[model samples]
Target: MYFFLINLSILDIGAISVTVPKSMTNSLMNTRSISYTGCVTQVFFLIFFVGTDFFLLTVMAYDQYVAICQPLHHERVMNRTACVQMAAGSWASGVLNSALHTGNTFAVSFCRGNKVDQFFCEIPQLLKLTCSDSYLSETGVILFSVSLALCCFVFIIVSYIQIISTMLRIPSEQGQHKAFSTCLPHLTVLSLLVCTAWFAYLKPLSSTTSQLDLVVSILCCLQ
Candidate 1:
C-alpha cells in the first residue's frame, strides 16, 4: 500500500508540474507564449503522467480488492516485488503512450495560428491548430486512449463488484462497515478521475470552442 501510495504521489506531482509551472510563470510574467519545443515537451509529459495516473489507480484498486476480498493473501499478492513491477510497468506504459501521441501530434503541419485557447498545450487544442488531414492520426490516438480507458474502467468495476460481494458475506455490521470505509473513498476518487478524463477527451470536438471546453479543461486540471 505504501509503495503504491508513493508511486501515486510521484505521478500526481509529475502530472501537475508539467502544466502548472509554466502556466504560473506565464501568469506572473503577463505573457502567454511557450516555444514550440516546450509545448511539445509539455504535451508529452502531461500525457505520460495522466496515463501513469490511470494505471496506478487501477493497481491501487487491485490492491484494495486483495486486501478486502482476500485478506489472508494480501501480503503475498501485493508483495514488494509485485509492487515494484506494477509501478515500473505503469511508468513504462505511460512513456510509450506519451511518445506515440507526441510524435503523431508534432508530425502534422500547424498552419493555423499557435495561440492555444487553453492555458496549457492540450492535445485537443493543439489539434485545432493543425492544417493538414494528417490530424486524423491524432484522432486515432484519442480513439486508442478511449479504448484503453474503457478496459481499465471495466476492470475496476469488476474488482469493486467482487469486493462488495465479499463484504456482504462478512456477516458482521462492523466488519462490513470497516471494509466499505476503506474502499468507498478510493472508488469515488477513481470514478471522478476516469469520468472527467473520458468526458474531456472522448466528447465530439466542436469547430468553435465553447464554454464547456473551458470548463472541461479546468476539471481535468483539478486534483
Candidate 2:
C-alpha cells in the first residue's frame, strides 16, 4: 500500500500545484486575472490529477481489501508488476479523461464575460461562461465523468463491505478492533472525497459566485 500511497501523495501535490500557485501569484500581485492559456492549463492539469487521485483511491481500496480479506493471495495478486500496471493505468486514464473534458470545454464559445466564479479554472465554472447551447457538449462530458466516478465509488463500496465482513469473522475482539481502526480512516477519507466532489460538481449553478464555492474550492485544493 505504500506504493499506492506514494502515488496518491504525488497526485495530491499535483492537484494543489495546478491551482494554488496561480492563485498565490494573483494574490501577491493584487491581480484577479489569469491568461487564456494559463486558465486552460489549470483546467487540464486540475482535472488530470483529480481524476487520477479518485482512481488511486479506488485502487487503494482494492489493495486494502486484498491484504485484509485474502491475505494469502495478496502478495501474489498485488505484486510489484501488478501495482505498477495499476498505477500507470490510473495515470493514463486521468490524462485521457482530462483531455476529453478540456477539449470539450474549450470547444464552446464563451459569450459570457471571462471572469471565473471560483479560484481555479474549474470545469463547472468554466461551463458557466459559455453561451447556453455552446456548453451542452461540456455538460455531457461532465455527465460522462460523473458516471465513471460513480462506478469507481460503487467498486470502493463493495470492497469495503467485503473488508468489513472479513473483519467481523475475526475471533478476537482486540483483533477486530485493530482491523477496524485500520479500515475506518480510509473509509472516512473516501466519504469526504465523495461528499465534497458530489456537492461541488452537482450543485446548482448561479449567476453570482457563492462564498461556499470559494470555501469548497479551497477545500478541494487542500485535499
Pick the lDDT winner: 2
Which structure among the candidates has the greatest TM-score? 2
lDDT of 2 by residue, 22-82 (tens): 8899899999999999989999998899899899889989999998899999999999999
- The number of clashing residue pairs in each candidate reads 0, 0
State how far residue 219 of model 1 sits from its true place (Å): 2.7
Candidate 1 per-residue lDDT over residues 1-223, each given as its tens digit = 7788788888878878888899899999999999988998999998998898898899888999999988999989899899899989999999999999999999999988878888889888888888868699889987898788789888999999999999989999999999999888777768777777777777776667778777776667656
Q: Which ranges of candidate 1 are over 4 A from the true structure?
A: none
Q: Looking at candidate 1, what is the lDDT of residue 97?
A: 92
Give the whole-model CA lDDT for all candidates, comma-separated: 0.86, 0.88
